[model samples]
Target: MCSPFTSLSSPTKAPSLEVVDLWFRYPRSSEWVLRGVSLRLYPGEVALIVGASGSGKTTLLRSITSVGRWIYGGELRGRVLLGGIPLEDLPLDGVRRSIQVVNQNPYTHFIEHLVGRDLLSAAVHLYGKELGRRVFARITTALKLEGLLGRRFFELSGGQLRRVAVAKALLWDPKVLVLDEPLMWLDDEGVADVVEAVRVARSLGKAVLIFEHRFARLLHLADSVYLLRGGILHSVEQDFVKKVQRSLRLSRHPQGGSGGRTTGRPLLLAEDLWFRYDKQGDWILRSLSLEVVEGVATVVYGTNGSGKSTLLKILSGYLKPSRGRLELRSRAVYVPQNVYLFFTEESVAKEFEVACRSRNLGRLCVERGVSYLRALGVDVDLEESPFNLSWGQAVRLAVAVATAASEGPAVLLLDEPFTGLTYLERLQLAESLVKLGNTYVITTSNSENLALVPSARVFKLVEGSLE
Candidate 1:
């Protein structure tokens, strides 16, 4: 992806939270994740940091918190200041209360039952009090998570879980909040609520920093934003404009060619599948039946835990339904949640070629832009190590390998394929999918993202049913 990449311009002014001349290396890792990278954040400002997965966005956040211990072993250098004071020199407990972190995946922060425990636990840890419960209820209710007060931690939907996390953060009332890609599993409304919450924090003169890739809804909320390119932060003057441009590019990827798929029998089929995380429990998908024809794009959508990922995994043969008949005539190439790593001496391109040929997809990998690296704004690092590639690059490589190796009208299924890509990278990926035309069934959280695809039949999984 580097060859055709045009250099981006640097911002003229320093950010509010100045990070200067920082160098870090995670223990046991010979390579440096961030080298001589510097960034800044303005006070009472919401800054969006965009970068491919493992590009050091997470590292940058961890370092800011002075929680370098969370990272195996990393050497900290240069100056990190908050309100013009060295962050490292500040007291540990003071730092924790000042710069708060709401990380990815709410499950990571799960603790105790009942939402009232949110502030109670923090207060108890600090001063031992029953008063925190009432305080928690008030704040949680204000955040719109009141309905989930008595609900178990694991019982919340993805968005609800994320809300609980935010409410906890708000209850603690830190001066600065660091939300790392907070929109991971949130729906349209959830995204809006979280944005408003961030704005509220800013209203109180708190600094809010958001790291994310899906800016479809975040274009307006943030006051200032920048792209964290390979740990080098680049400010986006008009994120609002970038968001609009991104939408236009996505609109072109799928429909560039006229709609209409060739008539063909269903290559994969499922009938009346009913299952749940636990038996004797309410089923997530009930009597669900779906079909995918050869050489066409089929997108699946549903609320979080509405069986979208479950159904995709079942279709991929990774999980067998508790009770149902599932069949697939062609080899299925699945892009799972995380890209798989291989212990071998293979370049990205070479590895993709080998994987495709091993699966009899060598032809597809070669014919389409699979093996071909992007130039002039296209990627071309297929010859590099899979472990060395960024999350976005890895996703592309996996998709490329899947397409190349499958036989017949191979069933291609992607579960949240755009998870870590920037809006621009997503456009490029969506365009590549359009190039794969037919033979793909993609599942995504949002429907507007479908606008990027010209004519994908949007089938939804609502309460365990599809149409």
Candidate 2:
């Protein structure tokens, strides 16, 4: 195999994938999401694009696939080239066969209920069963997904789903592979697996492009790094990490002293809790006990499939425990992993109004909601649809709404709230959470964010038990 860098000086050599003078804007929006952005990716190399939330990184990725063009209803003026041939000249089937994309959300790529069926469908659709089976076996082994074949797609944990999504894409054996936020929800071990998988793909001579906010973890693996900002792409030296670190360094919030030990009684308590989605299925939680003190944040750290989200749901009264006693002293506001789930209204202001009204907070004051969001480093137009906000913005809005609903000391439950947040945004969120002075039960795979709340009680959830 030849090094991708060696061919860069040759004018006759064409890149595996190239984007030239690209500009795009969604329908009804005057602003262009991508402005005169161009990129080149060579075979046997991995490239990375890093940007803040809503910086058009995802939009650029969507443009490559072109399958969701109609859904976005955007005007695009760009030439996306594959091996020096314009994408417009290629047949749709040919384009699909040559370039494969795994979206930020693994669930978006799932077409079948069972993992085996999903992999088989991708295999059969791309290649005949005989050849597909051979390819599928290789992908499964490479991704370490042997035991997951028999499980249902929905039953798999976040990390498992991400691996399966990548496996499904590999079944097509595309020449170029693009992944959006592949490292978002992964734990340390999961991150290692993904990095190894990327290496394996590069070793196979595939051009790989990864769009991520957490570039530090994947920076070492990237052959070239580009920073996307203000809708423009800027090539940066491989020492991009130092530049990003300096830019994202924020003033540390004053550490509130350790949440003093409980004196009278715990605000929330669970004893010998047991839960499972199915009667005969394996228990997601077993004999797990927890206590949440008033006005103290509790951080639950765990890898995927460790029941962190399940425990939060049970505490929020969204899901009942299969057995054991669970008690809560106050109403808990549950913010799900997908922040969009918390929005029932069309616009951000309307959603806040609904939350205020539902919580019986008297007259609805949208200003309060706006202020809350602004303090959390989310400064978006209130009239904009919540659906249009970026992932980090939506999470901030959701947290604001949850905090607004609490008239007194309350319990706030958040599951993976920092998924798409930038370093500065995470710091802002941590500062806001500290100021709220409420009992927070938050789950995250990010250990760095935990330092933001030094006073918070921390627990590790592993194999249905809290330690």
Q: Which candidate gets the maximum lDDT versus the true structure? A: 2
> Each candidate: what lDDT?
0.68, 0.78
Clashes of 1: 23
lDDT of 2: 0.78
Task: Name the regions of candidate 2 deviating beyond 4 angstroms.
Answer: 1-13, 24-32, 65-79, 107-137, 149-152, 184-190, 242-266, 271-283, 317-331, 343-361, 364-374, 377-394, 401-407
Which portions of model 1 show Cα errors greater than 4 Å? 1-44, 53-56, 68-79, 110-115, 127-138, 185-193, 230-232, 239-265, 269-283, 286-289, 313-329, 339-390, 393-405, 436-438
lDDT of 1 at 207: 70
Model 2 C-alpha lDDT per residue in residues 303-326, reported as the tens digit of each score: 876889899999999999999999
